[model samples]
Target: MKKIFGIVVVSLFFLSSQVNAQHKIRIACIGNSITYGATLPNPEKDSYPGQLQNMLGDGYEVMNFGVSGKTVIRNGDNSYVSTKKYEEALQSNPDIVTIKLGTNDSRLPYRLKLDSNFIDDYKALIHSFQQLPSKPKVILLLPVSSFLKDSERQTDEVIVNQVIPKIRQVAYEEKLEMIDLHSITADKESLFPDKLHPSVLGETILAKRIYESVVSKKKMDFDIFSKIKEEKKNSSFYGYDCVDFIFKGRNCKVVKPRFSASGLPWVWRARFFGIEPQADIALLDRGFHLVYCDVAELFGNQEAIDCWNAFYEKMHGAGLSKKVCLEGFSRGGIYVYRWAVTNPKKVACIYADAPVLDLKSWPGGKGKSKGSQEVWEIFKKDFGLSSEEAAMDFKGNPIDLVPQIVKAGFPMLHVVGDADDVVPVDENTKIFEERVKALGGNIMVIHKQDVKHHPHSLKNPQPIVDFILHSVKF
Candidate 1:
């Protein structure tokens, strides 16, 4: 009887351990009442985490470890660190962890007084997760917007002006993955009927967005410099790998660097290959990748933009930066500008060298300088425009689209030759600069005296590098 009892005890213990390891991935969601699915109908069944678990399918286990009105800051009214849920989360031994505990922290008196304490305490919370045995992949979430009448107690302004910046700082400082939940909820005011918490439909949106961000990223071991020697030997491109892949039935190329920066920042080079490529080489040396999508003859039509858009999405999924620094030389300016205008949010900044801003000015030869007759015909064909229509439609040019560019609001830098005949500066950069500034847009133009369109980039390439580094924070 004693032997039988001992065997049964051992069997039960083994079964318990086996059950714990059954799920391939375990997720622990740590947050305040918002994360607890506050105000949602049947929160346990329809909360963001619950919905996420359903989306992630049966291979994962998601546990919500949220406490009502808990602040990420330890000294707040009800600190999350002091909660039983925090202890429970620590014991959960999760593979992935999401921290979304700043909504209540946006409430006073913590709201007014958080300062650096929020960052320090948030870092500590992240450290706690990092030290866990599972070594979870930690993602921090910014708080959803607030809309209270007595805004001082729970103000969206304070959250945006104070809390959100600090959370971004933390993400940068820690090099961790971050989700801007505030932006997700900004326009969806109806989702928060009570002014703070999200409804069921809102929760569904939040879950889907988070799911996309997580799953879209490949999550492979990113080797900064993996196969340089082999690529160089095969493609004859020195110090870079010219990767050929098909996008929308068109053969495309992604010029990859052996080693790349932390956030995977890259410059999408537009038009021309060998004109003062010093800046690109310098950026590559500093761990930035350079890419080129061959749509040279297409100009900047809708089809070309669509093709580049596909490339952007693919590279972003392949772990390149979500935002790209667009570098356009000569006629390439139209490509970068048009693409940036169409997908404003995806651009870091624009760097143009002797750019052909106006199609009528460059290809049509209707301005102070003579244009390319062969290229002009191709442009007409691509745009489906007759000569009369092309001459009249300055509206499609970058110069005429200052309002849209200003609306997009990405920084612009142009290097121009004051004495150039081909792609004349006065007809392109001069007008663009004047109009952009008048419209309260950000543009910096560098003029080269007695220089023409022959020399493209700066000899040093330092200024261009500095501008891009500043814009992307690489």
Candidate 2:
């Protein structure tokens, strides 16, 4: 009886193992020659699918169903749907399907049919995968760049201008994730000796990119850091590399760390950048990217908010953290507070140094401090306030948004000098602190003894650093 019971237990253990093996996440890679690793030294081992399988470990089964010279359009010269590999892929019962079939379609014969048939055929193919018994999550991949000069064949011009746009349209219509392989590989022409197929190194890059997209819960399309070398003017910020670029005619700067922290966290400095370098430098040492966009004269108006909104979209698309730390100094405080109030959820935390909570308090000089009349006129124009009465009645200050700010639930930190005459602490930070505390909001204040607006930030910066790191949960 004991021998029989032991045999039953062993048999059950084997059955469980078999079930686990059968349940591995099956991935079907559908593409053309690029996906098949045509130019790689060893296609079987160095192909993107093989490398992806290794990266995914024992929990995933990645199968390469790529057939060379295949087009996504059904009426094209060589349609992927007509291939036996397509039939095999349909039978694989995959949980995930990655479709990357537009390289050969850029050829003249196939390119002609793309205008009418590309979107329809692509949707049909995606639908076929979606209807399978396993109901796989389908991901579309924009074809990699082809440096070949042959106009009649796969050319970078057609791929970028025509093919990639269609893929993006299809992905948008289908509501599926799309990875931008073309942009990722466009500058890596050296990896493609033949100008068409990626070598082993290129395949490795493709594999890693696909792996990142597959594993990430967020919808990451491309790595923005990859384009910094090609698109921006490089310089140095403190000790780190800084890249300057223009977006929508606005000057922008990004200071990158030697290594990025997890989730690619960043600090968005509103104005007066580099005024107080302590916290920025400390955060950089801890792997935080510092970024700035020039909305200086706009003064947190609708135009400034619109510019920030567009800039935020670009930054988020480039794979920065969804939430960002906002840093503001003096008049720059207006920009940060206005933007944060408008987009509360997008903020991780806020750090204001001798910040201007109320424009009326500083620029209007309606309170204890003597405000700037010249800047006040400009501020009024920017905000569309025609008279002093309009400026006085304006209820758009940060102090007015305490309830909304508190409800957004992001923490705040303020550094101020008791002797500040330019932007008095009593009329700004103190009032803001009282209102925020009354509303049960989280905020911290650091008072500088005998310090004025001449200098900003903390001497040690450890306290400010701790506040930021803790808020971002780094």
lDDT score, candidate 2? 0.85
Displacement of residue 79 (Cα, Å) in model 1 is: 0.5
Q: What digit string (tens of lDDT, one per residue) describes model 1 on residues 24-107? A: 688899998888987877888688898998998867888999788899889755889998899999999999999987777787
> What lDDT tens digits, residue by residue, belong to model 2 across residues 108-166?
89899889998899999999999999999998877887889989999988887788778
Predicted structure 1: lDDT: 0.79
Indicate the residue-level lDDT of 341 in model 1: 90
- The C-alpha lDDT values of all candidates are 0.79, 0.85
The all-Cα superposition gives candidate 1 an RMSD in Å to the true structure of 15.4
Off by over 4 Å in 1: 1-20, 217-474
